[model samples]
Target: MTTEIATLGGGCFWCLEAVYQELQGVQQVESGYAGGHVANPSYEEVCSGGTGHAEVVRVTFDPAIVSYREILEIFFTIHDPTTLNRQGNDCGTQYRSVIFYHSPEQEETARQVIAEMANVWDAPIVTELAPLPAYYKAEDYHQNYFRQNPLQGYCAFVVAPKVAKFRKIFADKAKSA
Candidate 1:
């Protein structure tokens, strides 16, 4: 199976990281900051929105098991891409909807998915489709956060709901632990 990378910023990386980690073809999901100006910006720097980075998850997946289109399908369904730079109570540039395409094919695929979602949803799709940027890895605690802190406040309240939705919508994609 060929390997490909898909960088997506839909909201908090922890939420996205948790869901993707459970997917069948997804090998790794690293929480990081992308579409930013500064290099290697700290998590705090990104939170302040001064670095212009969005909290993104870098997903390494096997194309044979899961198509890039399917990944994008999950991405659009789990988060509201219509809102600009915001998700739920989290409002900032860091929480914006963005697709950081690693290659031209990825770029086109991302755009096509957005178009598909737009046709299905009543509201226009506002998800940003951009070229891959220098992705600065997030802080240590942010990685695999939902698994490590499942009962933690944010994980239980926010992360869990997204995970449930993903599971319900894509039960076939779930990878046995």
Candidate 2:
């Protein structure tokens, strides 16, 4: 199967990772750091806001099953793109809304999607669009965090709601459990 990569940072990587993991076409969702100059930054370092990295998820998906636009549509729905450098209580540059496109086509699609979403939201869309940069996979514990820690406080209150919303709003797109 043909697979494409989409790197996105909407808030906590756990939230994005959890939602994307449930999407039908997704083959793998890796929590990671991107849009930074540092080499192989640790989660703690990125969280400090000193590494310039955003908490991002590298999603590998089959375009034949789910188009890039559809993935972007879900992203816009699941996170508050208007809130700069934060999503809910999560704060810092690492928590900013961003899309790191892997190709020219992806970049163009992101621009169009963001423009359309601007009309849908009352506030302006603040999601950053940039070419994909060096990406560092997060620590092992971070991968599939929600699935592994469903009862964890942050996973329960924060990530679970986003996952439920994704399932509720895009039931047809969700993978069968």
Candidate 3:
């Protein structure tokens, strides 16, 4: 099966990583930093907003089962794309809503999804659609953060809600446990 990667940042990478991990077509999800100025940004540096990076997840999925547009649909549903550089109480450039498209087709698809999803929110969608400049895998501790620390405070309050929302909104697309 052919697989394509979608890199997205919608608030904390932990939230995005957790939700995407449950999607049916998804093969893997890696939490990382993207669209940043740093060569190898640490979680602390990115959190400080000096790297200009968004906490992102590089999702590997089989397009035969789930289309890229569908992935973006899940993305929009789980996070507030209308709010720039923030999701929920998390506020920082690192927490911005962004799609770092891997190709021209992916770029176009992202724009189309944003346009279609705009009507759902009172404010215009501010999700940045940009060609992926560079992606630096975050520290191993950040990967599968929710699953590894499900009872952690942030995971319980912030990440778990997003996963629940994804499961409810895209039940058909969710992976069978």
Scored by lDDT, the top model is: 2
Sort by lDDT, best first.
Answer: 2, 3, 1
Candidate 3: residue pairs that collide: none
Error of 3 at 125 (Å): 0.7
Query: Tens digit of lDDT per residue, candidate 1, span 1-177?
Result: 689999999989998999999999898999999998998899889999999999999999999999899999999989998888899999999999999998899888887888779987778787888898788889898999999999999899999999999999999899976
Clashing residue pairs found in predicted model 1: none
lDDT of 3 by residue, 1-177 (tens): 899999999999999999999999899999999988889999999999999999999999999998999999999899998888888889999999999999999999988888889888899888988999889999999988899999999999999988999988888888898
What C-alpha lDDT values do all the predictions have? 0.91, 0.96, 0.92
**Mind sharing the TM-score for model 3?**
0.98
Question: What lDDT would candidate 1 get against the real structure?
Answer: 0.91
> Can you tell me which runs of candidate 3 are displaced by over 4 Å?
none
**Stretch of 10 with least lDDT, candidate 2:** 40-49
RMSD of 2: 0.5
